[model samples]
Target: MVFTREKTLDRAELEAYWKEAPATLEGHPIKVLSGYGPHEVWEGESTEGVVIAEFPSMEAARAWYHSPAYQKAREHRVKGAVYRGILVEGTTPQD
Candidate 1:
């Protein structure tokens, strides 16, 4: 699932958040594959930060979000901005 938070955060603080993210998600059930933000595109589509993660399972993904490591990461994100988040099920092929 991808999460987005609008332009509530300043550049410096957002950068700090980005810096702390990768290591924190390591060995977790949910893997953050990629994250990105618009580089001041000057478009009215809303400037926001985006995150994409891969989860082992929906339950595992939720668990990771509530875990202590993510909690720590959340602190910085909250300070930086306000966000809207969601989770979507991943596709799998049966054997």
Candidate 2:
């Protein structure tokens, strides 16, 4: 999943979401590829920050996103900042 921050964040809500979200990853094989940090946009509209995460499969990703724990955390994130999130399946390279 790729999430692009769209506006200033509510620090309190963001903090809360972060705190709760990590705990929810206990059973999922989710790996964070890129986190919110300094980024240079090559083209198109600019965004404040971006976060990229990878899951083993689409089913796993959906399970994580819709899980109760994550859903609870997502509420705080939604309140904190607007984001454009995209979930795309990646192709595996042939060995």
Candidate 3:
């Protein structure tokens, strides 16, 4: 997820998001690879923040994203900050 700060963040909404979003992870095999860490953008447009997560598959990622619990949590996220989220398959080398 790539986030850009578009406007003043609503702290209440963000607090709610942080409180609720993690609960939606229950039973899902989502792995947070990187987030809110020091990093430099080597290319492309600079963003305010970036998060990298790994899901079992595209379908799994979609399932989690579209889940009712997550959708509800996402409401607060959208209100708090602007984000660009995408799912892409990772490359696996063949022997």
Best by TM-score: 2
lDDT of 2 at 91: 84
Estimate, for each residue in 5-95, the C-alpha lDDT of model 3 and write its tens digit.
Answer: 4343787997898899899999888998887677787887666766788887888888889999999999998998777787788888899
Model 1 clash pairs are: none
lDDT of 1 at 39: 46
* TM-score for each candidate, following the candidate numbering: 0.70, 0.89, 0.83
Clashing pairs in 2: none
Question: Which stretch of 10 consecutive residues in model 2 shows the poorest summed lDDT?
Answer: 6-15
Report the error of model 3 at residue 87, Å. 0.7
Model 1 deviation from the true structure expressed as Cα RMSD, one decimal place: 4.6
For residues 26-68, write the lDDT of model 1, one tens digit per residue: 7776666767734454666774667778887888778778878
Q: RMSD, each candidate, Å?
A: 4.6, 2.5, 2.7
Candidate 1 residue runs with Cα over 4 Å from true position: 31-34, 37-47, 91-95
**lDDT score of residue 43 within candidate 2:** 96
lDDT of 2 by residue, 2-90 (tens): 99988857989988888998999989999999999799999988898999999989889999999999999999999998889899999
